[model samples]
Target: MASALDNPLLFLLVLLFPLSAMAQTNGTISLGSSLSTSDNSSWVSPSGYFAFGFKPVADKNLFLLAIWFDKVPEKTIVWSAHRGNLVLYGSKVELTSSGQLVLSNNQGQEIWTAQVTTGSATSAAVLDTGNLVLLNSNSGITWQSFDHSTDTILPSQILDMGTTLSSRETETNYSSGKFELRFQTDGNLVLYTTNLLTNYLYNAYWSSGTAGTNSQMIFNQSGYIYLRQTNGSVHNLTLGNIVSTRDCYHRATLDFDGVFRQYIYPRNWAGESWSIVWSVPSDICTAIAESIGSGACGFNSYCILDYTQRPRCYCPPNYSYLDSSNTFKGCKPDFVPQSCEPGGSGEEPRPQFQMTELPNTNWPMSDSEGYNSKNEDECRGRCLGDCLCALAIFTGVNCYTKKLPLSNGTIGTGTTKALIKVPQGNSTSQFPFQREMCFSFLEQEGI
Candidate 1:
């Protein structure tokens, strides 16, 4: 009944009440406050869908400042800072008054920082869209976690030129891994691996094959990942049936296995796991040679698709695992290397290196020489004559002579034959099919 124009005080109180409520719901972390991994301090978004805090690296004492879906069963991390540089258990991520977001280890050593120098009043907030932003006094975002992604690209995030998504070292290790999904300056979306230290060497395994002056990749709200050019043309990168549903959260990630895949999280379900919507380099074996220095299985070994559709490494006959604990370290010769010169005493005649033919086997890299019309016999003879040639790969009339440390070897359902040189011995005559079965059995038993 107090609808009179004189009720100005009541109207002002009603307007300010919503503003105060909105501020409370936004969940801002004021300057001088810090988030600690030991205390499990975090900033949760208004809807409680996303949270930003320090997550422990598996069972290790190290931690990483990360953002993840709060309600997910696994707490799937979408972005991280200082992933490569881990901090101690008591590490703190502080938003300083100077507008810098700094991560300091237990001893007060700086692990990483956003380096924002906006000397104004700033606050950090986790938005419902999953972006953790540092906002200036004018509500302008000075820095955001979406701009510096670790391995995932959430919906509405733009991956501009020069931005890259690097996979974690392993499923449990948050350190930088070997795989990279980068938006190159040449406008091509390339996937490659970097060499260790010093002068960096890149081995590109996959590319978008497009060239433009300026290009940007984005994960739109419609669940489609696309590359947009400066001229307004768009190209879809993910061609899967990802329906844009309200309860689904979509992300494109560079998986640790050197594969770029799009996954969908059904938040509405009680215990639903992330589902793969699409993947690049559908065949893992094809991308093995795209790594730096070695293949998917390292050196002196071959890769094959196991019954579970995963890549498994195996050594040919007469070779043993270099590191039995880790097969990716490749294999080593179980017998002594055959010397070209004659041996003394009753050492008998110098053992010759014999070829063990493996059908459906292929090695992509390290082709010293090849012939278009050569037969398998000629290819074998060429390798035997050349001291540097360690293996010969032949498919139809095409021959590829590989040197030692044969990389990217795979045994698929093709007609290719990989002739591996092994020490000539009575016990080495049988093919190593039993060894393959053993490896498969071990993998199945989670050994």
Candidate 2:
């Protein structure tokens, strides 16, 4: 009041106040503050339950700016800013004086940013409810993490129209995957799978089947998700009887394997395990056969229910996995390819390919020429005659001659059989032996 610059002590106090206030602590990051990645620096919530910082991805030096359960043993990440884009070590996330929050790599390249118009006095805080917000006097909240979610939705978070939750590329990779759960403009909550190479097209696999204006999806504190319409009607999105319990955290996620599931985590539990309470499309193989790019497994592989009742990928007879480390890459022929020309020494003609019977198996979509036949024998004969037919599916006089790289194959309680053509010289005994070896290798690797 009396010319503060005249006094040295008062001037010093004035200069240090803003710097002291900018110090990050108690989950708050004042303007011009930064958190380093190499140092493992983070902003922890008041209760120390959640932390926002850089997380290592699968033993690689690259890291992702993510929010995770701090107390859990698994360090389960619920949200990520740049999921598909990883930053190198020694990166830093800083809130500039201009109110812009930026994530920069070690080479000083900006990886991501929140270009908000908060005043210079803006400050960021990580709330106990797992929301990261930036606030200032000019605007209450200029930015928030909940407004741009990655894959998981927490309780009290509203998924408004045009919002989506994208699944991660894999259990180990933090990049975007093929599945997405979106709140459509028509007021329907839909789950879809996208071709990674072409993001423009999507195939819906599940939907809420409701339409109304001003619709919103919310995850309640009682471990239930519901879609509330403008007419005040609530449609339950979660399945099964789930009850609320104290000290428990619930999250709904679009899983990497193209499934939407709700899970619960008990804070006081000894093992710190998460239990799946509900899931959509209860059967993974129930996707529509005619839908484009609808299958869970890749081409040349079949989806089957494993011992644990989870969908697993398997290669057919005389075929081996293209990439042994990753089953999603699909399979390839292990034996010699059958030539179109008939080969024999005498007048007696030799069969070039042998039919291997795979009962209860069928491909999702028929990518072949359809033929009307009297029985399975005729269907097999038709496929054997056509050089382009790699396999044939026979179902009650309906024959589908599939071309190479058969996709979306599934095994269930259906009356269909897939007649796969293998090289005639290859012995059938090698099929079981190769399958057993593959299973044993996977088991030993603990996959």
Candidate 3:
């Protein structure tokens, strides 16, 4: 664990500003040269606009060996190596005399190595285009950062077919997230939400639909982003007035919220955060509709597009988030579930539950049952009587009941009003049984 090239975290970079940028120690690194977290040094591009070295991740104690835009005075990492395993204080990234670039722990055990499949590297450079490269004796690139993308692609970079860019786990976490932007071998550029911890793909949330051979996703020097085919055809990905690279810095990133955005940072900025000029599928909360898995937000939570067009999760009334630190973790009801068992009289237990009204809210998945209902009160009664019913959608005509742990919840004016059933007082402490015991009983195993 170790840190930055003097970067002060920017609130907009999704980084908290507790740690400041590191002291600048810029230059071309020759073979056998090394940069260590202990010294807080970095190899800066000739224009001094970008740097290659360690930057603070979780804190000053833990660092990510990566590259970032230098002049912004904030470490907005565009590319990184070994994100799953972070380096510590005194750790170093070395260009061995044998020409291999290796990252070693404080104990000198190699932890990460650059895949330098080309000729032996003679030197290394941090390029103004925001690419870090290992150079051959003749200055040819043996390996480059732009070729091995993390999440963001800078102007002049190409996302070659079959290459993928995975979003960070969260705004503050650098590990890979659930969203991915892949330039498929079929020549299609698709945005997907991956099943966490596995490479298994769920469904395409967005795509260019330009399936062919040898298609490349390019963020050109002129500030145009598009998919270029080998046959000289093109599909524009970004739409806006072209901002010259001479006046602004450009980065197309797959944000943690599952949106792919093109950001512009002015060269002569005056305390302004990066601006988003364009984004695909502008409203992810509505765009990420799928039959399987939770919607844009996790289970039991509704999703909406904030003013900035980012997906934000919210818990329904009488429920709370499962994890405060991560809204993507979804929500849980604060009250105990009503018991589904039959009362001693052999009748359904209806008196213990009541309904709460949620207008224009819907859970598209987990429909337990559906039927015609004449009025709101009847729809409410239908859900309250069925212990398995957690929510009932009343569309002014028919009623659709949903079960627990609801998936694909959406809150919008176009959706129907939903009546959620909950225990009358909602205080499990009043019951004779312990909460854990009640939970087991509510799960429908045995008393």
Candidate 4:
């Protein structure tokens, strides 16, 4: 038994062995197959359109064990094994010979495992439909990624009763977000905002209203999403299926803003990105307003529909987001909060806050007081004098005062104006008093 180190050429050959294996991977992977992020290798699908392996998370210096559209410029992830956990360099995913799919960290500790109970896997394959399947001895699928889905559902995918899809924390962060789409066991399909810390589902923002009839969520090959009832009747969730499945790739995702949208990308369209074909509950900022929980964006942040038709969250004057990178985390006051206690002589302290105007904006919910006859100035004055008032809404004819954690905030079509009370410091922080100017500034800088 001669050692490989005994010959220099043999040692070099050993170093290059893994790279050679990477190039030879095809549609079907062997039982003992493995890949790693350090080598940047993957088990590519037959058409080379999809891959199952570890991918580098941009700018974060981490890797994700997931499946994605391999040829796309964005390399959009369709499914991830562990959303809350990310791995460092040298991490690898392997289909163990013992019939288990395991993701291991650089230190060789298990991070995630695909659950299987019926039988051991004989082989695994990345199917053309973007599904990663583990086959049994008879080549029957024992486990598949389509069954335990995350946020996006590809064409030909089906969501049976009780299946849920969770949005990511942000566009870039892979952690579970505040929104979710659940097909309840009662046959109702609904979209909801979830308590991230507790996983408690709040009010339903949208629903199919087919409860007790038994329904299944299906994304057909032609790029249409519909709910099929037990009686064989189908109700389309998305209106049209104009995009041909043969010419384009499709996916329906529960976006982090709590909107469910269908998108398509032409197969031959050069240098293009995913285009939204349809969305449900179009006005997401107003759709989720309820007596409990933060609305579409987060507490203390207003939600607006940007040019892209997606929700855009912004922090008001004298308030900054709890996290700058992830606006959905909400905001915090930059200065010390007003003192609610009176002065030493029992006289109320001088007002330390003033109102800054934002036109066409309103915190639709969370009203502390409402005055039918108050004008804009009176609304502003009322909020400024009250230590409990965080904001005031004056809609030309009436006024409403709001407290902390403003919810259901939106850029409305009505004449509603938001008077946000902030510390009477930082003179440059105020937008121009003119309604037009204030709206323009809010739109331009999201102040």
Candidate 5:
């Protein structure tokens, strides 16, 4: 009932409360439901591009650490934690004994971590630019996940491809997957496959120039990364432009959910208006070039740009057709899976084939099981013998195989050699997607 300043003891306690809370935090900025705060139980970022607290999407146990534009009503989440995994009530975000910012729940078990470090003294601060920094008394960043990204690349943030693996395996989930983005010596942004240990992902250029230009722009405030040939060039490479083809203009996130996107603001009250510039399913049939997904061509096929909107799926060169339908039925070579059976006949022949682009594809189930091969030939031999192996791909002198022909939905063009298993009746020449096959009808209708 007494005024804080009038009560010196209470005033000092009030002042000390924030300091104590900060000390316990070890200087890591967090966003989420402030219902867990000891004070007013409200979470707010300094600049407001982000907020802390509970969201209503998931079940009750779900606690999310998310980021979105402060001004926009849609408040699109750029990053999310505990997506499917949620925490129970009574669990609070706290600085743990190990110096990591942990989200602990009622049972006193940790659900998540900021993973910050404290050498001398710890302090967490949310910078005006939206960067949540956990600083040592000396102002050094002991640990930061900014160096590690999920999918959304923010402005002023340097995307050191050298530090991160290539592309997301899926769109929404955050787990390590196949492709990755890299900074090339040529200064172009390239998407490469980590499995191949070479450049399998394609490139999006920022400017026509050399690499290491300080002129490139990554504005965290704007949530876009850009490139300029010179200082403040009129036209620059923007994240929106490079990735808009997928209809993922603003609602873009790079996690395991297959590089999620949205052309229009789905969260907007007026309804999202979007166009697909690049998308796996959207570009599957029509996508050309090596960096698209495997389905760009039919399974066990080469995507030939020679075909119109329907990408031409061709047999790998030298590989005889398994299906006599030849109208582009999935390409199969003379060698059957058993021909190269490890104990049977190890003599597999290699030949030269011409392909302007490789399909973006996923790893075979076998490879995901932790199968290690000495070389491509060994992998090929293994695939041939497995009988379960449906397709084989050799890249960067390494080989990978799957149990089924690449499908229109799952295949991409980002590999060197992809051998798909084709059914005798199916033709690679047939349009992979039903939509593509019916494009003629749409055109007839003035679509």
Candidate 6:
């Protein structure tokens, strides 16, 4: 596992050391007309909006090639060309006799460098759009920092979502934390545990929006990025709202705890910074950390809010407890699995779920697929008929099934609802009364 970036000092040290040599060119690199370096030492951008300079804030130790709001070294840094590596103090960016940009520390050790991935002897420039470009002396942008990003997602920067499963920690210190926002093939954003994945095949659609800056904004008017601000500019920074509201708290942020938050912005000043309008815990697959990790409900069960208990996990209406305990890991089907694997039968049976929410869910790591159906009834038929189908959840008019059961633990949040299909037992005419009696018994025993 990659280490998390929670220690800001460590983050700065690791990221700055190698970056001191940024903008030092060896082969044949040069700067463009629109840009300039901090001390006018050398490197420049194409539009004069950015500069290759040294910053003392992250660490007083070394200089780095950072893309800031502009010439102001203190401005919000949108990107860092090299954040991890040690550059000796007093290192200056010098064009190597080879034309490559090299940073030689006080002792002459090479720190961070920008090498041409393709073309050679190219001129490097920073564009007004905040892009650092490396172009052939002939003037073609060969490589740029805009193509890659550290943790901060800037405007106009294209993000390839859903490609990586884990997410970087928030900006407190710059270390890796929890929380991950991924892209679905269908262009939706899904949140899951950095580690645990789901078993379902259909992709989870948390929110939908355009791919770039037109939709996602890092800073807004209200001073918060994740939550939508009532006083700030009105635009979807990350994902579009599935529902609308005035009193609603809607924030979209990759939070410090390593969890993405689409929460309610606190409207009351005397109150909390903003009570949780909506939030997915950092851990989304296993029942480890408090309710923060994923799959808190355990396998084959769904976690839900218990109005009376505040944040306890509950089995869905149709589901039963796998264990005698009330903990999420205890949930199981009222009915047992017919067979473990798929039979040679014509087609497999389909399972179905009713209306409910699935909170803090990640993609199940198992090899599974989803089946599209017209409605819940259709989904039920599919899972029931299939021998291989174990558990299923219906969302956005589609049914998702798994060979392995899904994590069942859940925490509170209006977001935790989804219908699932489970096997039903053959009950007699008095089944309803019997079920009610059993439920009463369990409730009294606090099962």
For residues 397-433, write the lDDT of model 1, one tens digit per residue.
7888887667777777868888877766533534465
Q: Please give, for residues 191-224, the per-residue lDDT of candidate 4 as tens digits.
A: 9888878988898999989898866888888778
Expressed as tens digits, the lDDT of each residue in 327-355 for candidate 5 is 23455444444333344366555322221
Tens digit of lDDT per residue, candidate 6, span 59-103? 566445555644333344455545533343465555444446555
Candidate achieving the largest TM-score: 4
- The residue-by-residue lDDT of candidate 2 on 1-447, one tens digit each, is 588689999888877654423455445677787777766667777788788888888666888889998877888898888665788888888888877788998988898987565444378877777878888865488888889888888887888988988988877677888888889989988888777887964667788888664488888767789988898888887866775735687888887877788888887765656888888877776563444563777778887655434566778888878877767667887775556776668755644687888887887575588978769888989888888788899887788898876777788776888888887767454233336556866975899
lDDT of 4 at 323: 89
Root-mean-square deviation per candidate: 7.4, 5.7, 11.0, 4.7, 12.6, 16.3
- Total clashes in model 6, counting residue pairs 3 or more apart in sequence or in different chains: 91
Name the better of 2 and 5 by lDDT: 2
Model 5, global lDDT: 0.44
- How big is the RMSD of model 2? 5.7
TM-score of each: 0.80, 0.85, 0.86, 0.89, 0.47, 0.39
Candidate 6's TM-score: 0.39
Can you write out model 3's per-residue Cα lDDT over 65-118, one digit (the tens) per residue? 888888885657888888646877889888898888899998899988888987
The true-versus-predicted C-alpha distance at residue 304 of model 6, in Å, is 18
lDDT of candidate 2 at residue 269, scale 0 to 100 = 67
What lDDT is reached at residue 428 by model 4? 33
